[model samples]
Target: MPRSLPPLNAVKAFECAGRHQSLSAAAAELGVTHGAISRQVKILEDWLGTGLFIREGRGIELTVDGRQFLKEATKLLDGLALAAERLSGGPKSRVLRINAPQTFTMRWLIPRLSAFSVAHPGIEVRLSASIEPIDKITGHFDLAIRRGAMGADSTPFLSETCVPVASPDLLKTTPVSRVTDLTAHTLLHAESVADLWQRWLDLAGYRKLQGKAQLRFEPLYHSLQAAIDGAGIAMGPSALVATDIMAGRLVALFPDLPLPLDDFHFFVPPGAATRHVRVFQRWLLDMGLAQSPRPP
Candidate 1:
């Protein structure tokens, strides 16, 4: 006997609406209007000859039937997605999407991405850089790299330490033999690391010292570039500016006063881990460990 089924579109509408418990949210997720979701859900309810949702205060709630149906619908959708992926030449050929902050992506990850591509030629990587927080449920990214305290769902990747850095040219032109000499030079600030200078000063026992000229930038990378261009002294994260320091582009100031900062973490959406995701995760961890500063 042929299995009787409702309209696939209607089923999809119901599934998404049921999961979110809001027709508007479902519409947004499906890239449709609220009326479209409502109409499709109504069609599904009519086809089944039952009420799947109950009208509530400015929203809808899934009925008992809706909850049960949602479980089966979700399973069916997952199976369909898996089948499609398998039929499309499996996971190796799939694209992996990653979201990260702009500064980190530009100054740290982008430089090392060629190695990842060379290692995993079969998996194409798409990187998006933004400072906005990602919604785990609605975001399209497979993985996200964030800086801050690690949450329960995040995996710790790298810790950060900040030190004052200046272009070699700037340091030469404005030589400083002591920490207080910074008062004679410009101070570069990255809005992202707003309190870095203050933290460093507090640690260096120079609580009253101030910059002769202060320059502020919205992004950390901008401040780093300014420091490299001999504009001013900027507090730099070791992980992001180590290559510059080693390459003689920037010189670390008061190396003995390194200020510890927040760590970096990786987060994945809730679901079974794909082989490609696992591979990328391992590669990221390995690269982080390699780039991290080694103790003396």
Candidate 2:
């Protein structure tokens, strides 16, 4: 039986367009005109019988279906690229794909990533940021990092202590010398870990504490940035906010009541740990150990 397939050219165009969320960017990457990319995407949408993207003013956003399709398409394209590389006996350039939480990647891993690149220039790291837990993440990854109890195929490298953090300027405006003082200021919450503030407050024996105002942000990175900007107080894990604290952009409050969170575990699937992956794992473990704790 002959296999039925959508136009391969259209698929490639749609995949590139979807990945960048920009038709012009996709056109540039694929060495085609913007109209060519748009037509190809339209062909894909028609073939799939669904609207892949919703056009916004001067921009485009992926629909739920679009997001799902992009994940599968990306996986398929990555597999094909790898197969082609192997078949063609291409230059031996190691590409290591890593999946990690968005906020953690921004606030921690990225800052330390350059050192790894300097140490091993031969291996290229392609990082994908997602809010999903490592096990729940889609698509291909050589390894994944998440905060949780250790798993059979994972290694626990670092644990973080949580504390309330506020910008120095905000602290000057509304001092939080005591645990209850947090209630006097707006509480910035990361929707991903909505209960972090409550948990820390409970640990400090203030179970009924509520802030003057609450502002929730999707992805922990935004909340941390809000805290740095003096918008409000936020729950800061030592691993994520140590640099901010050291830079004097934010200050940790009530240091005596530190709430220890789960250790960050890195998962390496069976047979996926190549030499480059092993090197990355060693560098990660070393970085975790060498990281300095937030100052008292």
Candidate 3:
């Protein structure tokens, strides 16, 4: 009988877990949940029919079988990567296909992509900018970054929250002193959801205000840019606009917590997690976790 081949991801994950000696650490490196790395390691162990590691107090120590397999798995991963490199283009040339919103990509993700590429040399990043949701089951992309709370199941990734922001200059010397002061400025509305302004008004305790504000595009990015250009005050996504806020181009407008949405997330299609993808995910998460605002 021919030997059964284990799942490629399971093997790759197991190799990382063994090398790191901690599933959580491997997860951080791979930009996946700790549970995901653990399950993959278990799947690999089941196929090999041997214990790979024994869980210790805080971390696990490699078992005898694990140590032996580590050597072989290490070689296997290296060989597979080399083979893929040659077959695709070269070891220095890998591709990471990402689908994100056009405005978000332009204003936020695009500026940071060069840094990612520098860290993971020779990888070509192919970006498909759209507001349309990616069908992970259909492999629309190898990676995705979306915004959402903790409990969302549609995506493998989650974002912090949305925050109200506008250029710092708008805040100073203007009569718009408090949350209610916002009524004086042109409230830019570029959200696809028709009720966005209403929800923001409710958050600001002005839901029943006497007049409505200015409105614009369905996609928020355009209006966000308008806000930057002093067109009006626009609610900015914390994930995509942190750099802007930090640069003093934008500042949070209110103390009240903003409304939450589970619209954004990152998804890696089944069988689509590649080394290049793994590298990119790590970089993205680092930026997100460090720069993102608290979830409302």
Candidate 4:
């Protein structure tokens, strides 16, 4: 005689709820209602004759049995997904999920993504903007583009230099012929790169410039936009501001004083690169190289 199995929907509800530790979160992930998830979980608990969760004040905790069950359930669910994906003819119409910073997405990747789309019509690219560091083990990201020194685990894609930029109109109004002339105008600052001005100033041999009117933004994208709108001079990374400079929207101030900054790197989950990921990576690297400023 064969052993009977529990309800798949109830098992799924328990697995999702156990992983998130919140029925609401599980409901959101599964595209179901809170009550539905609660009912399914209750049914699962009754079938097993064990309490899976300890309900607390607006929260739930997994019991020992629940924890052990979740571990096994997760493995089983993952295996099922893998089997389904393989049987469905893998990589035929896969979605490549990419997470990158707001500044990079706005000024760099989004602008050039159309070409990638044109080239690979079958592969869909989904982008999510985040400045927080990628957590490979827990995150649902295929690839992450970040600006920093490349670690042993990451691959460097584009090297960058930091330069001051402002709208052409602003440059005309407040002529900055030399480094010291910047003292007369507002200095736009991005919180992410707060010390960029100081670093650029140091490179230009201006150690003791007096305080100027300053406008600070939390993200580099906001500061870049402010610079483009003639609000103030901003420290622009070469990889990000190249297109703006070429288009005559923003003018590079003191082009001679370029400060070497961290290169952009591509981080992927630990595994062999899939066909979709490999093609995208190649396209991005080529685009970055082409857009980089040529040596004079």
Q: RMSD in angstroms, all models?
A: 11.4, 15.7, 7.3, 13.9
**Could you tell me the lDDT of residue 147 within candidate 3?**
48
Misplaced by over 4 Å in model 3 are 1-90, 136-140, 148-158, 210-212, 293-296
Q: What is the lDDT of residue 183 in candidate 1?
A: 90
Off by over 4 Å in 4: 1-91, 293-296
Candidate number with greatest lDDT: 1
Q: For model 2, how does the per-residue alpha-carbon lDDT over 1-296 read when each residue is reduced to its tens digit?
A: 99878788988888767765667656655667879988998999999899999988756789999999888987887677668756988546699999888888999999988988887776899999875755565448888888884344466677788998899999887777777787799999998998898899889999998999999998888999999999999999999999999999989988888998988878666447555775687688778877843221
Report the C-alpha lDDT of model 3 over 1-296, residue by residue, as the tens digit: 99778898998788877764667656755668889998998888888889999998767889999999888987878677769777987667777888776776887789887788777777899998765555532566777655442122223333545656777676675645566667677777775655666777787677875324575777778888887887777877666677788788888765457676554556555456677775676576566555653342
lDDT string, candidate 1, 99-171, tens digits: 8999999988999999998887877989988766766433678878889733445665677799999998988
| Model 1 deviation from native, Cα RMSD in Å | 11.4
TM-score of candidate 4 versus the correct structure, residues matched by position: 0.67
Clashes of each: 0, 0, 5, 0
Could you give candidate 4's per-residue lDDT for residues 1-296 as a string of tens digits?
Answer: 98888789999989877865777656755667889989999999999999999999877889999999888987887678667767988646768989888889988999989988888776798998887767643356877888883344455667889899999998788898888888888999999888998988888888777437999999998999999999989999987898899999999887777999988887665442455675686677677667663342
Error of 3 at 165 (Å): 2.2
